[model samples]
Structure formats: structure tokens, C-alpha cells
Target: MTMQVRGSKLAARLTASMAALALLGTGAVALAQNWSTTVVASDNGHKVGNPKAKTKLVEFMSYTCSHCADFAREGDAAIKLAYLPKGDVSYEIRHLLRDPFDLTAALLTQCGDPKKFMGNHNAIILSQEDWFEKGRKTTRAQQARWQFGSNGARRQAIASDLGFYELMENRGYTRAQLDKCLIDEAKANALAEASQADVEKYGLTGTPSFVMNGALLDGVHNWAALRPVLDKQR
Candidate 1:
């Protein structure tokens, strides 16, 4: 009877040790892999997550639109935390250049390398309230420079008056580099044309729109609505 009891106690200890080892192995696997930090750039935008993800989500957002900013605030945390780490889904925020304000912000976001796009993007979008208010207070004379003159001159005027220059400067960009990006007629025109194409292609009615798996996710604008659709795809 004593021998049987001792053997039972030893078996229990071994079983517990094996389970703990299994759990540690699983944790190591989880810690070793997370694809959320990856980002790739396309001509008109930056993409995040696995390049060949089964589910691709595209957001058509304009810097001038408040709703787009709201999405950035809400959707970013949810998607980056929950979905992007999985490596099965991808996200891209495509530009919708509505006006010079939109174009200026987009140019600033696209200023540095591809890796800088999202950080620059959030910087501009999150601070829209301040610069937009400044724009509203500007005199007609001040606003005129944004609309009239050469393309580079008009872009420069808008950037200066709206505080975009200061925003990018805070993001570690030099004045000369920001100016070069802001005045690139070719890049600006390409952005404009791409936005136009997306608008027509999607039959989009507003600034905050979505495309999922190459199909437009109709009537889904905010994060709340977007969540269910992404879950279903997963």
C-alpha cells in the first residue's frame, strides 16, 4: 500500500511538470510571431500586415473629412490589436484628395519613406481640428494663395497657412524635405487622379468608405459596422 501511494504522488508531479512545459512552449510560439508591425507601400498608399493575406481591407479616406479621422481613432486600435497580428488580414488606407487641404495633408503623410507614411498620416489626421480651425479663421487674402498661382506655390501657401508645416516638423521632418514633397506636381497630380479613379470605381458617396477583398463593403462606414463584416470574413 505504501509503495502504490508513493508511485501515485510521483506520477502526479510528472504530469504537472509536462503540462507546464507545454504551456511555456505555446507561449513562446505566440511571442515569436506577430505580423502587425509589417508595412508595405504602393503607389498611392501604404498597406499593413501580410502581403498575401486572404482578406484585404481598403479604406478610402480624405484628410479633409472629420469622419475619416474618427475612423482612424477608433478602427486603428481595434484592427491593429485584434486583426493585424493574425497575418491573415491586411489593411490599406487609400487617399481621397478632395481639395488642396486634403492634398496638402496627403503629401505630408507621404513625405518620407513608406515606413513613415502611417505615423505621418496619424499626425496629420489627429491634429486636423487645430489646423482646420486656423484655416476657417484665415482672411480671404490669406486663403487666396492656396487656390491661385503655380501648383508648387499654391501648395506651399496652403501648407504654410494651415499649420501643416509645423505638424510635419514636429514629426521630425526638415523644412526643405517637406517642401519638396508638398510641391511635387507629379506626385500631387497622381494622387488626384488615383482618388478620382477610386471614387468612380467604387461609386463612393462619401469620404469614409471601404473595400474588402476587392469588393466594396456597402453602407459600412464606421468601426462598429466594419467589425462584424471583418469577423464574418475571418
Candidate 2:
């Protein structure tokens, strides 16, 4: 399918998924105690909490995905404040690229230092509506930029003309620095390859999917449904 067709289908699926998750009710209550900590980039994700933690939780997410954004808004603090402090569970976020916009956002997030990845990730997700709106308004000439040139050129065009560069700039990134990141062909290709492998390996159908201890989670996509599963692991 064409990129436009694929993006439309993905957006429809994401909206439906977000609606379903919303009906699941509010998320689990916050933990009484909280701790300050940081997460680092790993092989396929940003790793947070103890590496040796017995229960490993991974989230396969796309930046353009509304459900993934919801999870970030609803469940992120709980994970960091409640679970990470316990030191028995570790959380990692693996990107599941859904489109050019998702690819751009993923690259920009990775451009930051590993220690700042999650912070940048959260900032992007939290402001999803703003940048995604800008993306949808991209002119035909801007859209065509993706079809030609080196991967770096394509990324730079998307980031510069599509408003992603401005978005990152507001987050403290310089235009020169972001331009270099857009050209990092290795990082971009590795991310895409990894996401493709996940699609085939897990038979993924949507974003915000979950895995526990190396197994794809079944029948539990939202944080409300996922909390109990993590509790069992703990």
C-alpha cells in the first residue's frame, strides 16, 4: 500500500485502540513512595529500573500512535514512581515504527544522550497532538521529499519542513545538532530493521503492545489490564 493509505489505516486502528483502552477505566493507583532514577538506551529500548530486575517488561510503541501516547500520559509516572523504586521489575520501551513521522520522532529521541532518551520520549509523546497536526498539514512538496534523496536527506526534510525540527528545538536541541542526527543512517536503519523484525516475530497488530519476560502478552494492552500481570510477576 502507499504511504498515505498505510498511514490512514494505522491512524484508524490507533484511534479505535485508544477508545477501547479508555473504556477500561483509570489506571492503577500511584505507589505511596517514589524514587528518583534514570533510564538508559539498550539494544532495542530505553531501559529503566534495575537491569537485574526479575520481571522484565517491554512496551512496543509508535510515536504517532494515540494509544501509545495515552499510555505515556496515564501510566508513565506510575511505572517510574511506583514500580522502579522496588528494584524487582525493569521497564523498557521498544519503538514500533508506524510511519515516516514515527521514524522522524524516533530518530530525534535517540539523538539525545542515552540518559535523556526517556525525558525526550515523554516530551514528544505528551505533545503528540501538536506535532502530529503539523505533520498532517505537510504540503505535497514536503511529502515528496521523502521519496527521493539519501536517508539523511529524507529525514532532514521531514524534520525541517514538517515542524519536527522546531519541536525538538523547543526541547533545547540546536538545529545543527538535530541535522546531524537526521543524517545518522545507521541509527535510522537499525531502528527500522528492529521494528520490522518485531512485526514478524510477534505478529503485532497495533501499537502499545506488551511483553513480559520474553513472552508477548495476550489480552492485555492497556495499563489497567497490564498492572495485574506485572503484580503477578513481582
Candidate 3:
């Protein structure tokens, strides 16, 4: 009986030791994974996740695009929660301006500190419907204000009259800071030129386009379709 009891106790100890070793091995594997993020050199795109990631994903999106907004809601979440954590994927967003409203939103998003760009971008995209409705309610005078001024002035007018300024304010921006961003002619022109250059280079058809590993992806429009491609690359 004593021998049997000792044998049982030894087996129990062996099982516990094996379990502890397994847990430690799992932790070591997790720790070995390398994850990191950085802003691109151009300062036009914000990148997140491992710089040396096997999969590089880029999105060309317009703020006023409903489809882009949809993708931002679902796709951005999945990237942050799944791919980024795995440390094998990196994601970037480049603006493809579609109109003045898009430019206004883009400028406002980039106007803030670089660290806040993604947060602002996500907020702007998520609140598109509400602000777009406000834009539609603009009076003829408001439209003229947005249409008549110089590029900087016009963009500022559109931002204020169409509620883009108000939207930023809701996001904790001050009027003075936004006014400075709104009237930055050089930045606005640069953004416009860059967007046009991307269009010509990529032969882009519309907003919410995707590029993976430097190849423009065709027919891969949503997270459901794109997720599998990312997995394969990983």
C-alpha cells in the first residue's frame, strides 16, 4: 500500500511538471515573436505592425467613401486584433482624394500630431454618415463660400460651413488649430498632387483599393476576401 501511494504521488508530480514546462514553452514562443510599427518616410501614410512583416498591405481610401468607411469598420478591427498581434503583417493607409470634402477630411486628419493620425482617421471614417448629411443641408451661400475662394480658403470654408470643423471639434480639436490646418495651402496642394500621382501610377478606378506586397489587388474588396490573402502571405 505504501509503495502504491508513493507511485501515485510521483505520477502526479510528473504530470504537474510536464504541464508547467508546456506553459513555459508556450510563453517562450510568444515572447520570441517580434512586433513593431512605424510611420512611412513620406509622412503621407501611417503604417502599423512589424516593419519586417512578411505581408505588407496598403489601402488607398477616400474619407467620403461609404465603401471605404465600411471596410475601415470591419477591416481595421481585424487587422489590429488578429494580424498585427501575430507580428507577421504590416498595414498602411494612403489617401486617394476624390473631392473637396475628401481633401478637407484628409487635411484635418493629418493636421494633428502624427501619433494621432490613425485615431483621427478612424473617427472621421466612422462618423461619415452624420457629417455627410450635414453637408447636404448646406445653403447656396455656404456652397458659394466653399466654391469661390482660393484653394485654401475654399477648403476652410467647406470645413466650417459643412461641419468638418465641428466634427474635429467634437474630436477635441480647437478652432484655432483647425483654422491653421484648413488654410495650409502648401499641404493641401501637396496632398492633391500626391493623390493624382497615385491615380496615374496605379490606374485606380475608385476608392477603397488594396495593394499587397506592392501589387495592386483586383477584386479583393472587403475584409472577408482580403483576410485569406493576408493569411497566405503570412
Overall local distance difference test of candidate 2: 0.82
Q: Model 2 clash pairs?
A: none
Off by over 4 Å in 2: 1-36
TM-score of each: 0.87, 0.80, 0.82
Error of 3 at 130 (Å): 0.5
Q: lDDT of each model, Cα atoms only? A: 0.89, 0.82, 0.82
Model 3, position 41, has a per-residue lDDT of: 30
Q: Which candidate achieves the best TM-score against the true structure?
A: 1
| lDDT (10s digit) by residue, model 3, range 73-189 | 999977877788667788888899888988888889887777677778877899888888888898888888877868778888888776777778887899999989988888888
lDDT score of residue 64 within candidate 3: 84
* Model 3 per-residue lDDT at 68: 92
Local accuracy of candidate 1 as per-residue lDDT tens digits, 124-201: 898889888998899999988877899888888988998888888998999999999988999999999988988898
Q: Superposing every Cα of model 1 onto the true structure, what RMSD results?
A: 3.5
Best by lDDT: 1
State the lDDT at 93 in candidate 1. 89
Candidate 3: where are CA atoms >4 Å away?
A: 1-43
Model 3 misses residue 151 by how many Å?
Answer: 1.7
Question: How well does candidate 1 score on lDDT at residue 167?
Answer: 84
